[model samples]
Target: MIIIKQYVSIFEPMKKIVVLLIFLAPVLSAQNYTIGNWYDFKKGAISLTFDDGHPSHYNTAIPEMNTRGLVGTFYVNFLWNNSWAIEANDVGHEIANHTKSHDSLSYLSVGELHDEVTAFNQKLENDLGFPIRTFCYPYGNGGESDSVMFYIQDTVAQTHLAARSIAKATDDEHYKYDFALSERDYYQIRTVHMRDSMRSYHEDFRKVISTGGYMTYMFHTIGTPGGWDNMEVDHFTDVLDDLLLIKDTVWIATFRDAICYHRERKTANLTTVYAPFENGNNWVLNLTDSLRDDWFNHPLSIKLEKPTEVVTILSAKQGGIELEYTIVNDSIVFNAIPDNGHIIFDILNCEIPIVDLTVLDETIICTPDSVRLEVNYDSAYSYSWFKDSVKLEADSNVFFAKDSGNYFSEVKLNGCPINTASVGVSISGVCGVPNANFESDVTRQFKDEVITFTSSSTNLQGTETYYWDFGEGSSIEPGYYGPGPMEVSYSTPGEKDVKLTVTGSVSFTDTIKNKIVEIDDFNSCGIYKEDFNGPDFKFWHWCTCKYGYNYTMEFVNKALRLNLTDSIYGEWDNFKLFFYEDSVMKPFDFSDDLYKPVLRVRAKASDTCRASFSLLDTNWVSTAGMKMNQIGYIDLTTKYQEFELDFSNLFFYEWENKVVDSTAVWGIS
Candidate 1:
């Protein structure tokens, strides 16, 4: 933010410079104007002042401002129990009076007025050891007959510099009166603000600047509101931010400074003197402005044209003290005070050139053959190379590598180092990575099938580890790279993923035929491992082909136990169960699908009798009467053990020719 010089000649109403291509021409005013006799040439001004010192003002608001190096003026209602008002003053904050007892001076008796308004100012001033000039009427009321205003100006607390009113006194005359320091300056200095409208400070500030006058914003008890007339800390700080933005052009100061500046400018005197410099040497100048140093200590800004052919300034001094200066296009600008008397500068020869520079480092790459890195740049620069962050001994644009790592190149221009990266390049190298391919005997078949596997790995060279993952709690530990066929089997399976992996520096994995063989684990054959509860023989009606031996069929112990009692077995006693679904007879068939038909049964019998489950067609009778279909012979035994008979390979012959309908229309017999 630029310092706003309130020099009273704030407006150059008639004089302004209008430049036309390649030429600047100043229009003379016939009269030089200053903005309100100010310190810096600022056109507008503002002050962040709070009223009725609330604890939030001290505890919350001030710290936030202090962090940002800002300060506020607090008008305390001494009668209120707000204990933080004194702390506000202790921190260099301006504390003014909001009146004792906070009585409404608009209607208060003369005696009550003095007690509420006058007494509060003196009491606060005495306690804080700082004279209080700025005042805020309690509840923003100036007594019934101008008592508060009269008191501030005359007898109550003569130490007071200025008092503010919140009546909005928006009348043009009042604004000009306050801004122009007219008769009603103290009582009628109208504020351009609204309650709780801190959010609008940015635009509101523009209004103050447009008016080009002394505009004072009035508030009551900032921080958490003790009443409806208070403001939030965030809301207050928002206004502060708006003030800082124009700190360069707008004069932001305490209410007291506002009154002091006008007084100081009236009495202050200034003069400028310069010491002659040798030809082609330095030039020096001193300026002094005398006012009461303690009260008018605001820094003044000075701008001077750069001397002919002066390249730069080496140093600046004021009263033997070094100061910072900015040399802007044929102009030297600096801030100083009259108290220091004058400023001196040593001119020097210096030329700082401007150039666009960028640096880069190429990332490392891992490949197989060879790696080469190179750079592209202008020849005007001196080149230096680096490898892996270490400055290389060579100064070249290209760096050839026997090993893999990061590399970069730097160029020096006018003794300044500028670095950049190499062009990305890489080659091939070795690290174990193999194609895990394998071959299997068959896929999609019955369960418990042993699948023979043959490894077909490619580019395999390393301390390799081999593994076989048979998708179901089944795994094989890795073996060193070598070996041919590995035998594996699947039991009780569906589609089991038999995956093979060969791991090393770079691991590899693959599955035989991209999918494991799907096995129909007896589930599709209905209930082979079931009791009579399943939908097998329980739902099929049973009858003897020709009853010869005494037979009993019953469900016992959850098992379908067919008993043949004390008799010799004969082929005529064969029992067959008919397949039925809702009384619609359908033949058992698996020839349409892939699973080869198989008959498995658990039986118990003696040497004289044997039981077996087989399939026989109703149309099986031929010239050979009572011919059997596909019948599986069972072994006679007293103990029970299940045995499987693959009827898919079964066939029958009649008259020197094998029956071709072996898989046609079969019932459980």
Candidate 2:
């Protein structure tokens, strides 16, 4: 007793066409004997067929099909090292003949055509013990000339059940050939050449079901090189995943199986004997046909209106051999071969299998993590999983979920479907709340040097706003949102407090304050440059006047102006401006060079006056004999003129160590 229950049964109206394409052995069945147009009585049929002996057929295409438990037909060449075809055949995939060398039949002579076509079929049959049943034209070029077409067709018809040709690689409605079983010609069958578009495949699949016609997809290579047209593996997998949704509506079979079933169904005959058993319905159906059972042995799907009071199929058998059957609401479906003997179905009001689904993992998942969902394992039924009212590709009882949606399972017990309650799974972080943060490339730089600041905030929902403030005196004003890495520089030297604020969706706001960035007055090469038009001067200090003499240094008209007055000291009144930070000149790297550090000052005296500026030692005393360190007393005039006081022609090598105690002299008398 060989029984396998792989029929499809989803909850739908009786008018909704349902079918299954499992490659199970033929089973026996119910009272009504209306033969399905396609296998399992599907609305339409589809066959994914590939050409050539490309390695990708074995490496990529075969594994993907096997993962879905779907099958395809591969037309291979005998001339190439085509050993993978045997393995494909062992796994129930069709391996037919392309040709010996795939030479175009139009260009070949009659003798050459026979050799090209028959030799491949003969060789494959000898190796596999089963005659090769289908053929494919290389590049879909069957024959351009009439004579060539006639010879190729006559030769192909002898061994092949069908030969598939091409009908452009597009979704033009004209190519949608009516595959209504009896309406199609076995030879010269038109096919759609598959390209790298998942949308096109989807459209084609939907059209096949709507028109109730057969659709064949022709491919050369998948996710590999060295083929005329190559499709991305992702596109191919996406098409397959989508096809799984309607696996119950459309019959996905090999070219040979579809041809055999349709040809046999055309002339099939059935005799039904309906009799009432003990408080239930009983059926004994005899399915037979005129075609040779040896050649047309493919099982045809039988659908009947299920009896209402019959809750269980008590027994189903063929010629005293027990068989399997499925009970869809109002429709009992199962597979049976013609001339397979008497198929008996006994319906009873017995208890049926009960199914329950459970979630095996957490209901709340992180953004990247997934949860596992499963149904109770039952060998008596098959399963179909769904999410948010859409069918999923998972057919097994278990499924791993990464996306957030309501998930449930449809358990089918011998064609009777029961849907479980939906379990909701939610992702934790979706809105992406704003978290404000930033980083600068440099902590301290020269006044004119630019610093780059980049925002490193999280939870950005694409509409987040960014605000950056690079402290006062910066080159840019604090305004609305700006993008990073923001280049900012300050004209005034000080410790700058940088701030970054981000406002995300739903009025979520966050702000972060970065550490202080110090801007220095001197350049990298230890050169001091300053303009005293400032709110603050970090390098200069105003010392107390000597012995009650008053000296004032103030910003008058944006310039540092000095005023001296004395009541006691009279003409001896003097004041000196010293360098800040304990008289240490900052950035003092004037060594190993002939740099004679010149002081350029723009000034004008109120009267004819004398003044001297010098570099003082650590004790605040001027270097008297240090020519390179002193600017001698020079006469000043009323008119403001730029004065360049060049130091004596001497390289100050010792000044490299003067960062410890160096000071500046700015005394006026």
Which candidate number would show the highest TM-score if scored against the true structure?
Answer: 2
TM-score per candidate, chains pooled: 0.39, 0.44
In model 1, the worst 10-residue window by lDDT is 9-18
- Per-residue CA lDDT of model 2 for 305-349, tens digit only, reads 765666667678887887767777677777888888877887655
Candidates in order have lDDT scores of: 0.53, 0.66
What is the TM-score (0 to 1) of candidate 1? 0.39
Model 2 regions lying over 4 Å from their true place: 1-32, 79-83, 143-148, 169-177, 180-184, 197-199, 273-283, 305-313, 319-321, 329-331, 346-669
288, model 1: CA deviation in Å? 5.4
RMSD of each: 32.3, 28.0
Q: Give the TM-score of candidate 2.
A: 0.44
